[model samples]
Target: MTFETDHLGFLLNPLDWQPAWAEQSAEQLDIALEAQDLAIIESLRNFYFEFDLSPPMRPLVKHIKNNFGADIGNSIWLMQRYGESPARTLALLSGLPKPKNCL
Candidate 1:
């Protein structure tokens, strides 16, 4: 499928995002792009569709701990841990940059 460019040279996907205001650190950073063994694009889209905002790593951690029975490692290395979470992964999928001050 070809991503036809708009008159302003931007892609118009259903995410309702804009290229000029793109919050992503890299254009090629898709959640499904990494960890080939684990692909969750469909899930990400579903979650995004349900919630207008992407869940940050903090809430994601709590959600994961309670729901998935797992913690995102210890809190001492929060930046490191949150950065590696699926929420961050989903953020990447949504063209959003890493949480401001994540590192």
Candidate 2:
């Protein structure tokens, strides 16, 4: 499907998010992500599929470190991409639900 930029600048097609869609979402969030960022999205997608849930910050960070390794799993580093609410931003970009209890 053709995606267009929303007011926020990111392209969103929430009903049809695949891992590839993260790039457009990141653009909307007004950040340019590195390869690491894309990898994180892939990991998040895997986590969502396996657990049927989106992860909160700590868990998301931990999962990345555990699964993808230290080169791209630091919470501080992730916070830089989406500010203090990485989980919310990530869920939005990944087209998953905001992590349970996220505000």
Candidate 3:
């Protein structure tokens, strides 16, 4: 199916997404994403913009670490917060394409 591309060229479904969608998605997952989590998702969006692809786990962690610092970038921490598949959660909430190797 054809999908609209975000500025970064990632497929997006804007109709199902809004700024609040991040928090809402987290709620559905039975998790709570605080400001830090939102910041990480924003960072992921930015990463896609720069690199034109969603990040896999390692790169996602590294990007957040470099941009937002270790306090929010550790993969284990992210997995704990977002579940075992953080890249999928991040992309779902951010309205971006599923990251490579996410499945």
- Each model's lDDT comes to 0.41, 0.73, 0.74
Q: Write the per-residue lDDT of candidate 1 for residues 56-102, one digit (tens) a residue.
A: 66664554444434433233333443245545544544443333433
Which candidate, 1 or 3, has the higher TM-score?
Answer: 3
lDDT of 2 by residue, 3-80 (tens): 554554333444567655676666767878777777677778778888987899888888988987876578777787
In the range 11-72, model 3's lDDT, one tens digit per residue, is 46634556666766567678777787777778777777778877888988888789888987
**Considering TM-score, which of the candidate structures 1 and 2 is the better prediction for this target?**
2
* Prediction 2 global C-alpha lDDT: 0.73
Q: After superposition, how far is residue 52 of candidate 2 from its true place, in Å?
A: 0.6
Candidate 1 wrong stretches, greater than 4 Å: 1-41, 71-89, 94-103
Of 1 and 2, the candidate ahead on lDDT is: 2
User: On a 0 to 100 scale, what is the lDDT of residue 95 in model 2?
Assistant: 71
Q: Which stretches of candidate 3 lie over 4 Å from their true place?
A: 1-11, 14-16
- TM-score of candidate 1 on Cα atoms, chains taken together: 0.39
Full candidate order by lDDT, most accurate first: 3, 2, 1
Q: Model 2 RMSD to the real structure? A: 3.8
For model 2, give the 10-residue run with minimal summed lDDT: 5-14
